[model samples]
Target chain A: MNTVDFLNSREDLLSPGISACQGCMAELSLRVILKVLGEKTVLVVPPGCMAGAAVGGWNKSLGTKIPAAMPQLGNSASMLAGIKAAYDLVDPDVHCLAYAGDGGTADIGLQALSAAAERRDNIIYVCNDNEAYMNTGFQKSGTTPHGARTSTTPVGSVGRGKVNFKKDVPMMMAMQNTAYVATLTPAYMNDFVEKVQKAATIKDGLVYLHVLNPCPTGWGTKPENSIAYARAAVQSRYFLLYEYRNYEFTVSAPTKNIREPKDVTEFLQKQKRFAHLDEQDYEEVRRVVNSRWENLKKLAGL
Target chain B: MENEYRVVYGDSGLYVLDTASWRTFRPVIDETKCVNCGTCLLYCPVCAVKKVDGRIQIDLSYCKGCGICRTECPKQAIMWVKEEE
Candidate 1:
């Protein structure tokens, strides 16, 4: 099969009228998912960056030729379930996909999500976690990690940004014992696409895809450096690639250890998220990162 | 199915789970509590739980029972029971 063509198909789904900022990781992820899903799928999205990126005001859609439903933020999962039920009753061939941001998936919309996943709804649910609520002017969301700055978490007089760690969402979803669950990053296209395509073909319950999308505008990094930051996050073991199936958890990709825990300064220096961090603050962040990495290794049984 | 697979994204390898090797999401179906509302069937993505031979029986092979069936079932006839190793 021609893989290049498979990747090329996404160009059509990505139209020019959307409001995605330059180098927006959320837009890149939308393109990736659309390319793999193609015309045979229906996308269900709730309000967030994706809603703005996919469909602008006045009943206009970005460029997706396929069918779409933009419901309230919390209803994407339930709507997807309803759509799948309708399709099964009639066509049974179309793919029903629910795409939501971290705030919608991990925080606000999690209840409906739990209901959908628990029912083993035949839908591909993708959580494009850009860390914080970038669309709402960089507010802290449940997915935002400790030490990151947001309007709500404002880099304070105390010199610390956020004080809480990001939720371990992928593992939490996998704990549901569903057939497929994976953590991915745009830097790893081949891996991400493979996971998405596999999920598309399965006629089972929910398939959870957690994509770590970096936000240049919110994080105070260069627009061009978003993908680079994404790669760094994975390499630093801040985010590891893995999949869980049939009660076995497998690290799908090996995170070659980067020596010395990569001075949080490497990441902090680029993003405004840690602009307030000083020597003492940077060291504390480093310690937390190291502890998390070691615990991750233990979880993967490596 | 092909024995050979291509590497996608960051790595390559397939971990297969065969029938005997499969892990069931073992469910407890309390027929006494069932109202026959069909909420479980409506929400079940795999259709693993059904009115087989006139009563609710779970097809353990396909039922991961993520518990939408249990949660949505108004009568709460279904409960996710863990499978023993």
Candidate 2:
């Protein structure tokens, strides 16, 4: 569909007053996702930004108007699997979506998620990676990049932010050989919508979407710059947008042929989370980012 | 006396909850300047802008007033106005 047609066709499932911070891309992603999944979808959200964004404060109902179940931390995948199993008895066409943050998917929920993938559960699992434990107050998580500062990884004397690299959850899911695995960002709205649509069509096994949702509050950036940062991430090759299906890997259209790539340093400098990085730290981050780009190019047979 | 709760299943009809009270700033479109290009409609996170009868309408009920539509409008047709308390 064309841009206008697609925009007009959206049946916005999310209500306002969600308490999501201004320009919170997790909320944006959830809205777009519901538009694609439509009314026959059941959402299973754990305790994270996605849940907080949907049902916060005095709002007891999940504003999406869809049947939603809130599971404990790290239990979303299994809960969604159970929900999908029960739905199979009545209506097998209902989409079961498990949405979680990086902390829920990469750290606390990995075991259950892996088990679900192993069982070939018919569900679509979405990991909205904001790169930290943002909802609970900007603590470092497994996906937090090295040299980025967070509450847990404060840049103080004898402390140099987070020392570990971001976890590659998409690669791990692809290793499981699930029906579909892809990375997306809300900045690329068309691409993001298409991927979610494609994932919904897969009936045999699990479909995983690892979306990079830039958090203005946690990332220490202006809310207006949220989409700019997302675009910068792709242009700098810090986050490669690609899909893995049928044992084949292909980079998405936007990041596939990036001529005159922007420097990763420019992208890092925009966020206050990386303000503490010195010259040597910048070099280290650049080296790591370049190597990741090279590795992805090799995989894509460039 | 017995305490009882109704267990409703998938029957919560779409609730059109008005969220204008939560808005600190609301988007006001300049109709004369607008070309109905639909650029603002595409970038609006909440999908608050709707096209009805070939004109764009912003539904304040679902609009969190994020100002993304104001920021993304190519024609600069959307203006952010402070909501009166």
TM-score of every candidate: 0.72, 0.92
Give stretches of model 2 more than 4 Å off.
A54-60, B1-19
lDDT of 2 at A83: 94
Docking class of 1: incorrect
DockQ of each: 0.01, 0.39
- Model 2, span A1-302: residue lDDT tens: 67567758877666555667777888888878888888899988889986776542223444566777789898889989999999999999999998899999999999999999899999999999999999999999999999889999888888889999989999899888877899999877788888998998999899999999999889998776778788889998889899998888889988887887898887899689998888899888889888988888888798
Worst 10-residue lDDT window for candidate 2 chain A reads A54-63
Model 1 Cα lDDT, one tens digit per residue, A1-302: 33433453343354433455545667667766776887688877788887765432223323355566687888788989999998998887788887799999989889888888899988888999989888889889999987888888876566466788888788888888876888888766667778888888778788888999887778887654666687777776678788877777777653544444455566667677776667887677677777866765676687
Model number with the top DockQ: 2
lDDT of 2 by residue, B1-85 (tens): 7744333233253323455666788888899999988876766666778888878988887677667777777798988888886
lDDT of 1 by residue, B1-85 (tens): 8845333211112111222223344557786888665545433323344554445566655443344456556676776667778
Root-mean-square deviation of Cα positions for candidate 2 versus the true structure, in angstroms: 2.3
* Candidate 1 segments exceeding 4 Å error: A1-5, A9-11, A60-62, A254-263, B1-85
